[model samples]
Target: MDGRRPEWRACVLSGAVFAVCMAGTTLPTPLYPLYQDKFGFSELTVTVVYALYAFAVIGVLLLVGNASDAVGRRPVLLCGLGLAALSAVCFLCATGLGWLYAGRLLSGLSAGLFTGAATAYVMELAPEGGASRATFVATAANMGGLGCGPLLSGLLAQYAAWPLYLPFITHIALVAVSAAVLLRLAETVRERQPLRTVRPQRPALPPQVRAVFGPAATASFVGFALFGVFTSVSPAFLTESLHVDDHAVSGLIVALAFFSSTAGQLAVGRVGVRHSLPLGCAGLLAGLALLAGALRWDQMSLLIASALVGGVGQGLAFRGALADVAAASPGHRRAAVISTLFVVAYTGISVPVIGVGLLTGPIGLEGAGLVFIGCMAALVVTAAVYLLRRPEPARV
Candidate 1:
């Protein structure tokens, strides 16, 4: 217990750093609507702005996703933190629409660096035989931090001075603290190579990981797509249709999906990885159904229900999918493999979201949302059927 204590502390601290970086990625979520009003941009423009972040993330993941594995995790993470701070600074200095685009693009680079590297760092910091607990720590930090982003910004934007400025300022401070924390943590990669040796990794699965990759990637894509739509447009939906203009309320509603996702990740431990994927798909189906009802009836209750239910579903599938893929991967290539999964996931977030945005002009937000839901439901259902037919190994 004595020796394990320090390891556990390091593990938790690493997760904290992970959380801070992810929080920065979503900090602008609740504020997108405000930007829309301030800049007088169309809903399509808002979606495009949001999708830009994911695109940058995808670009980074493809280009240099495994840099940590070669040069060591610390350097990559520090770069990520640096990028995060710069992203925040961009937001604080926003004088026009161009600034928002630059900020989000930089934010995406920060998240892209952190996602694979940090998750691997947190898990590696765990003491021997603590993989399961460490998995929880990493996943909770990711989802919890994401949930907190909107919640933090919403409250500040609604009640505090400088709704736009204060949130980014606060984020900048948090990034500083996170960087300090990261510097103190020991690097987990023992066999380090030069940065020049860290070439871009094409997204391909090793033979061992191929089977698990398919179902895992499918579920991850669906879950992230669900999140993409919710985070990108839910605020507008609340304001325009439900007549809910409260920033705090919009933020809370968005946060619920992420918070519930954390709750769902917890359930994976009890449910077992074997069952969790299919079950998560089922939850997604229900969540999609609820979202349809909410959009069709324009009911606030149904909207909230969709967030909670769908979030849980996302949590279940994502954790299960990640665990399986990680277990199957060779340690040398783990981060790259993880980044590949994220690429697919972020693709889900970007492509479908832009599609929704494109539809919004002709059909309206409700119509666009329903169309998005229908497409996601079909994808999740396909993933569910596949999972049930060929359940991945229940390693965890």
Candidate 2:
């Protein structure tokens, strides 16, 4: 272990920067309806615009998710920050629907680059003894950063002037400051390769890990799907069904899930990898049930309950699956394997939400949401059953 004081300091700094960049990605969450009103688009168009970001993220992850492991973390992260800035610029210059699409695409690229690279970078800079805390820092930064995005934007957009302009403007300032901090941080990958040497990392599981990867990846998919639906459609539900026009309230309702997700991930340290997965599955089941109640009753309390419960399930399952799969992977192929898992997880974020969008045209938003919850619930249950039948080894 290098065990240098500079290393720990840099680790925490990088995590803060990671959070800031991630916050930019979701800042538009609560503002989407405003964009829709301005751009004059359909609900389906909104989902399409939102899903575009996930597709872009998945594309970057598959194309070069492990690039930081080769070309050094700093360079790749800097690239991500650049994309983030470009996204902010896109949003700031929004004149029509195309700008929104461009912004989301760029944001996706930024997030895809940041997700694996920033995560590994933070962990690498920590003191060897501080692995557990460092892991929490990295994961919490990811989910928490995501949680803050909408809340910040919603408040500014709702009460502050220039809703469209202010959010991106504020994010631009954050990106600039974060870029300065990031530049001062140390590069963790000492023996770096050229960018050209990095190529697409397809999901290749090791034989031993292959057993655990399925249930784990499935949990990740289901969790992310729940989040996707929430991020894309739940706001519309809040406004239409609950008669909530308050952007702050809408943002807070959405933020609840991501915040709960961070709390759920933190629980993994105490719960252990073996138990977190099943517990996550349980949380997911309960969450889905709550969401069904929300749909049936149209109660604001039920909706909030669903978000909190579902977020916890997502966090527990994702963290547990990630730790187990990472442990089971051979050192040489570890990055690619984890990237593969993320590819699956990110796919969940896009496809299912789009499915809901399509269904919304045929049925109403609530009806489509009911169908979505039912489908996702069945998948989560299948995954839970499989995990029960083939429990992960305690150490893994």
Candidate 3:
């Protein structure tokens, strides 16, 4: 116990660093409209730009998801932060759509490197016998950081001098501070190898893990799909349908969903892993209903309710899915399996968002959003029913 304090402190600091880095990925969420006006691009182009980040994340996960285990956590994390800084620099110097794409790609790469590595790193830094609490820290940092990005950028852009440049500049400063903090932390890997030895592993499932993977992955897909639409297109919905054009307001609305998700994740410990999947699906279904109402009636209140309620459902489902999958996976293949799950979740984020964008031109934003809500509602209901039919195997 005497020697554990420093490591625990390191865990907290690392979580903070994780939050800052993740925040960079969504800094432009509120500013998408500004970019559209500046560059004169269509809504489809915006979704495409957002999908570029998800694509880069999936690519990195497939190629090097477990690189930190081979090399070391700190190095990969530092590399991620460096990429994050470079991304901010790109945004700061953005003169065209290409720069935005480049910045988003770099941001995605940063998130990809950090997602698995940082979560594991935080857990390792915790005092022994604190795995559950550490897991909460890791997850909260992940979701909380995502929540903060838009809020920070929105506030700065609303009140600060340089709406576009200030947010990235602030992130650059934060990254510099986080890098320094990271330099002081000790490496967790004992027999770390060189990065050159790292190779991509195929994201395949073993026959035995399929039963546990199925429901968890389904809930995750539905949850992430909801988040995908909210983050990618909610601003347009607010602007075009509701006549709410304030960037700060849009950012706050998006941030609410993520914040609510953090709350939902915290509830998982009390809810227990066994119940989380079905409960999450229930919440997601309700959320979809709220979103549908928002689209149908064009009510801002319904949109806000959807963000809060749906976000909680997503949070519950995603974290529960992660815990279920991780517990069932063999130690040797845990990281790979988790990476596969993330790929599925991210696919939810990217594909549905792009679908909404594509449909916006034909059906308009509200109609496209309603269609998305219907599809996600169906997915969530199916997942819930599946979970009900096949109860999770009882834990000892």
Candidate 4:
């Protein structure tokens, strides 16, 4: 969205709307075990159901990823919000595994639409001189919203009446309010094109960008993979192995990672871009080791430590990698390259998560998680070494 001036209030409201939609994507994080019981499915099935959302998100990214740029942000965002509401309804009325699968896919579609468009919309709505602060608002909204999902739902499920039903119902109300707020906002695209003209353009990376992309993308991939494991299987681990069955606690543990990630990202300004990547890798390594300890000892404290450390690592490396990659990309190909990077990072969430699922049946959850940590640790170590050997120049 890029157009005539609107109150900066509109920008913040748009960020809030973005937050609401993103929240729906992860609302079920703490409730997955419940779904498993209801459907009489194994942990492997639960992971598969969760991975379906990521796969759907990837599909949407490949197909209609840029549709908002042509058709206008409001149209796309509204549609996204609508899909989010439908996803919630699917959950509210879930009768079996099919409903769960459908809900996840729809949620993924909503997220794929909102990810780029909402960020751009939030930026476009910013008033003069408010760009930096507005960027923070948008960034925090994305991560903060993800953090809030489990916290809100977990509390409601644990303490309130009707565990599964209330969360989606509350979210549906929020989506309604968001749609109203969205309608009042000004249209950002001044010269919007027809949706028909928006095609799936293949992502291209110039040679120079490829050099930067490899290690930078690795940081993002590993970070996202860590999160994927936490969101999909950690609750099961907590309940079954760690002997912690409280929904609120589970939600908070999951939420901590996303919240810590925000802190990690904010730290980048002080840590310096060059330091952030390697430092991030170090944090990730620490987090991984902590996770291994958590699994081996079945210690709640160790698990919490892993979340906080891993989150910081993810935020630091991912943000720094993005900055360096953007700096290296030719101006004309910058957006495409960034999009390509995101696709790879998101794949880390899906592919590794499903792999854990497959391994859960044979090796067990803790063993599968250890395998995941070992693999991601290797990737993060490689990235760290590369960054140390050849630091990204301060200029570019």
**C-alpha TM-scores of all predictions:** 0.98, 0.96, 0.96, 0.92
Better of 1 and 4 by lDDT: 1
RMSD of each: 1.2, 1.9, 1.7, 3.0
Q: Which stretches of candidate 2 lie over 4 Å from their true place?
A: 1-6, 394-396
lDDT of 1 by residue, 47-106 (tens): 999999999999999999999999999999999999999999999988889999999999
Clashing residue pairs in candidate 1, if any?
Answer: none
RMSD of 4: 3.0
Sliding window of 10 residues with minimal summed lDDT for model 1: 387-396
Candidate 3 per-residue lDDT over residues 283-392, each given as its tens digit: 99989999999999999999999999998998888778877776666655556677788888888989999999999999988889889888888888888998889955
Task: Find the number of clashing residue pairs for candidate 4.
Answer: 1
- Let me know the TM-score candidate 3 reaches against the reference structure: 0.96
Give the poorly placed runs of model 4, Cα more than 4 Å off: 1-8, 127-134, 206-211, 325-337, 391-396
| Model 4 Cα shift for residue 259 (angstroms) | 0.5
Each model's lDDT comes to 0.92, 0.87, 0.87, 0.85
Off by over 4 Å in 3: 1-5, 206-208, 394-396
Clash pairs for candidate 4: 2-188
Clashing pairs in 3: none
Ranking by lDDT: 1, 2, 3, 4
| Candidate 2 per-residue C-alpha lDDT over 133-207 given as tens digits, one digit per residue, 9 for 90 to 100 | 677788788888989999999999999999999989999899999999988888777788887899886667668
